[model samples]
Target: MAYVITSSCIGKKVGECAQVCPVDCIQEGEEMFFIDPDVCIDCGACEAVCPEAAIYPEEEVPEDEKRFIQLNRDFFHRD
Candidate 1:
């Protein structure tokens, strides 16, 4: 995964990120938005516009907030 939407977005998903995403890889969820890792092209446009500052590149994700990486994956891949 490249960018992960963290807890900061839990209740503040404004959808601007989705609009800016060239690939339309960001999906709205009950709790937050999940970026489809496979669909995302890593363009970083969404990250630049997120008002909540909830998006982070995988390598730059804070250590404690890393769980969102899996959260994003499971959002689309859950059984």
Candidate 2:
């Protein structure tokens, strides 16, 4: 499953995750960074380097932060 970037990263586009992402799936947003699920390799590299602890597997994201899974998708799919 793809990794999701949660609210903890909303205002912190620190980009440590992006820097370590081998597939370059992470993209900068106005307020944060979003993982392109379509491009993600599910390698977990981004999650390992996130200092904010904001990255989680899509299925493992905490209940309270699950909205981020959709948010990440929306960020890339918005028309």
Candidate 3:
């Protein structure tokens, strides 16, 4: 699964994660950054560089913060 950026990133926009992403899947949104699951390679490069520790693998996303999984996906709606 791909990674998800949680609420910890909201209003922070610490963009180091996007800088290290090999596939350029991380993108800036109005309130935070989102990882485009369709484009992410699950390489964890972004996760390692995230200063706020806001990124997590889909399966490992904390239960309370799991909504960000869908939030991240919905940002890149393909329709």
Candidate 3: minimum summed lDDT over ten consecutive residues — where? 70-79
Error of 3 at 55 (Å): 0.4
Task: Give per-residue CA lDDT, model 1, range 1-79, as digits (tens).
Answer: 5789999999888999999999888999997899988888888999999999999998899999999999898888988
Clashing pairs in 3: none
| Candidate 1 lDDT score at position 45 | 98
lDDT tens digits by residue: candidate 2, 1-79: 7999998898988999999989899999999999998989999998899989999999999999988888899988989
Winner by TM-score between candidate 3 and candidate 1: 3
Worst 10 residues of 2 by lDDT: 6-15
Identify the runs in model 2 with alpha carbons over 4 angstroms from their true place.
Answer: none
lDDT of 1 at 20: 92
Error of 1 at 1 (Å): 4.5
RMSD of 2: 0.8
Q: How many steric overlaps does candidate 1 have?
A: 0
Q: Over the stretch 25-75, how does candidate 3's per-residue lDDT look in tens digits?
A: 999999999999999999999889888999999999999998898988999
Model 1 off-target regions past 4 Å?
A: none
Pairs of residues at least 3 apart in sequence or in different chains that clash in candidate 1: none
